[model samples]
Each structure stands twice: as structure tokens, then as C-alpha cells.
Target: MRCEEGPLSEVYDRLRAEIVDGTLAPGAALVETTLAERYGTSRTPVREALRRLQQDGLVERADRGMRVRTRSPEEILEIYEARIALEATAAAGAAQRRSDFDLVRISRAQKTMTATPASDPAAMAESNRAVHEAIWAASHNGTIVDLLTRLNNHLTRYPWTTLSMPGRWEEAIVEHAEIIDAIEKRDSDRAYELAREHMTKARELRLRIYGDDATA
Candidate 1:
């Protein structure tokens, strides 16, 4: 959770936030000198930040310079597929290993998500991410948490949230409830199945939305 402290960290944090929030849209150019001037620092920090972002898969080398990555639908689907596998494993681990404190945190996160207004898709999406983060933490596997965090960053780059789709908010809440129930009961197998099913539904909805958007 602790990032390096310094000018480079500042630049990286600012840029990453902008990209995730869609201020720096996909395919947008990332010019080093321009960012350096904007951040009121020399190009050194900007250059290093850009390099780190590239390694994080948030930026890519463009014909002229680096730019925010623009993922194709297929690429997005692949990321979701990876998430499905990892999330299921994390859920199983949580069921077997979660402490009372961990369960409380997970329940709180889910409650926050449920309380968020469906009309506010962005807030709902953020709360939804929080729920998963708690679940991942309950798993007590740093490696899985790290990988899922990276994949989530990539997914959040998209401006839209699947939670915005009609009925999806309710559906996701129900699905999350089932997963929570399994975890609370210490049923690892059931937790794994529920988590896999949840992510699979999300992937399906995402694909359907992409197809609809393409046609639209």
C-alpha cells in the first residue's frame, strides 16, 4: 500500500488517477515535457512516472510518444477471464481462513455497496470495488491481491460501469450476498462456486454491452 515517496511518486499517482477517472482518456497522448511543465517539475520525474505507468500496463509506446492504453474488447474479455479464476480462488481461501475482523470488513463493504444509489454508477462501481478488495484481503494472499489489483486498475480505465446496466445493480448485490453467505458458513467449495458464477455473469454482461455498443 505504501508507494515510494518523492516527486516521481507524486507524478505517478496524479497521472494514474487521471487515467482511471477518464480525464486522460484511452489513446490520449502522454508527452513527457508537457507533463513535466504541468506538474511544475523537471522532465525527470515525469519520465520515470511514465516508465512506471508503462510497466503497469496503463500506458503504451505510441508512434510519437507514450499514450494511455486502449484495450480492445477481446483484451478486456481476457482480463475478465483471469479475474474469474483468481477471484474464485481468493473466495475459497477467504472461506477457509477469514478471521472475524475480516468478515466484518467484508460485510461492511458490501453494505456500503448496497447503500449506494443505483443512479450514481460511478459511486456504485467504486463501492463494488471496495467489496472485492475486502474479500481479497480476507484471503490473506498477497500475491493474489496484487495481481487482482493490477487487473482492476486496467478495468477501471473504461469510462462506463457494468453496474449501470438495467437490473445489474440488484443482481450483483444478490450474487455478492450468496458469496458472503458461503464464506460466513466456512464453505470453501460453495464460496468458490459462487465467486466463479458471479464473475462469469459480469463477463457475460460486459460482452453483451460491448456488442450492443458496437452495433449502436
Candidate 2:
């Protein structure tokens, strides 16, 4: 049986999309009445949608209203530390368990990431996500994938991409290629080390670019 989407679900999806894509922006006000007017719905559905988003950790209570959640520089660093551990594990698992089909998917995602125009940081960032997601899928670990997905949502709320920094895109391309090579060789240890190094480099660049922003 097919389940039909309700008004609340519709509002939730739209609002979540906006929040994740940086359309609403971190710490942007989310007023029930304003959102209701924008979505052409009553405040009832919008309120429920806000509640769900809050549960998802995408919305937070401000002094007098709801706003998009913001991560301080310290929090962002902590998230990266968690990602570094989990993603390295995923890369090692992929090297050990990936099938031919999984390799094919990963290769395709890498090619897409490399081919994306560097001038478009947004597109490059999206392509980069595809490569990471393909590698995660190759790991065959549902739990790792789910946790990374949730963490990535928080990271993407930023309007800027680390790939936009000078030379970062090129450097990332090389790092990704090396990681793929390690996985293709079925060198689990090598893959794990490479993945950790790759994420650590990214973490460094993120701090270099956004460290000045106290609320980043």
C-alpha cells in the first residue's frame, strides 16, 4: 500500500530542504507566522514542522522564536574529529568488503567529482559528497552511513565550501584519487590511513578559512 504525504510532511520537507541547502542560513529566524505565509499554509502545520526540525537538530529555540541551529568553531571541530574516526573506518571496510559493482560506483563518483568545474564551488562540493557517499556505500555499513549523513547535514548549513579556498579543490582531487587507489588495491590499512589524512587536511583548511568567524 502507498502512503500519501500529509500537509505537515510537505511543510517539513520543504523547510528541511531550505535549512540544509543554506537557503534559510544558520541562525536565521524561523517565525511560525512568516513561514506559514511563505508556504501558503496555516500556522498549525508550520508549527508542527518546526517541532520536527527541532527534533532533527536543524532548528533551535532563540530568545523569542526559533532559528536555524548554529555550530560554534569548537563544535565544528568536534564534529570533524568524529568524522575523521568514522570515515577512516568506513574506508578500511570498503577496501576489505567492496564488490566489483561498488568499485564501479566509486570510480564513477570520483570521475564526476574531478570533472565538475572548479569555478562552481557549490557543484564541486556536491560532487565531492557523491564520492564520499559512494565510498560509504561500498563499506556496507548502514550505521556509519546514517551517522555520517546526519553529521553532513549540520556541516552543509554553512553557505561556503572549503573547496572554494585556493588550491583546495585540486588538492582534494589528488587526495581522493589516492584514497581510491588504496581501496582498489584492497589495502585496508592503507585506505584507512589515507582517509584519515584526507579528512585531517580538510579539517585544517576549514579552520584556516573559518576560524576567524566566532560563530562558524
lDDT of 2 at 135: 96
Candidate 1, residue 26: how far the Cα is off, in Å: 2.0
**Model 2: worst 10 consecutive residues (lDDT sum):** 1-10
TM-score of each: 0.91, 0.87
lDDT of 2 by residue, 1-216 (tens): 212223898899999999988789788999988888788878888899999888777899999889999867786798899999989999999999999999999999999998999999779989999999999999999999999988786676655688998888999999999989989999999999999999998888788767656555
Q: Give candidate 1 misplaced runs (Cα > 4 Å).
A: 1-6
Which candidate gets the maximum TM-score versus the true structure? 1
Q: Pick by lDDT: which candidate is best?
A: 1
Minimum summed lDDT over a 10-residue window in model 1 is located at: 1-10
Model 2, C-alpha of 52: deviation from truth (Å): 3.5
Question: All predictions: root-mean-square deviation over Cα?
Answer: 3.7, 3.9
lDDT of 1 by residue, 1-216 (tens): 322333788989999999988788889999987887777777888889999988788999999999999967897788998999999999999999999999999999999999999989779989999999999999999999999998886776666678898999999999999999999999999999999999998888888877787789
Q: Which pairs clash in model 1?
A: none
Candidate 1: residue 135 Cα off by (Å): 0.8
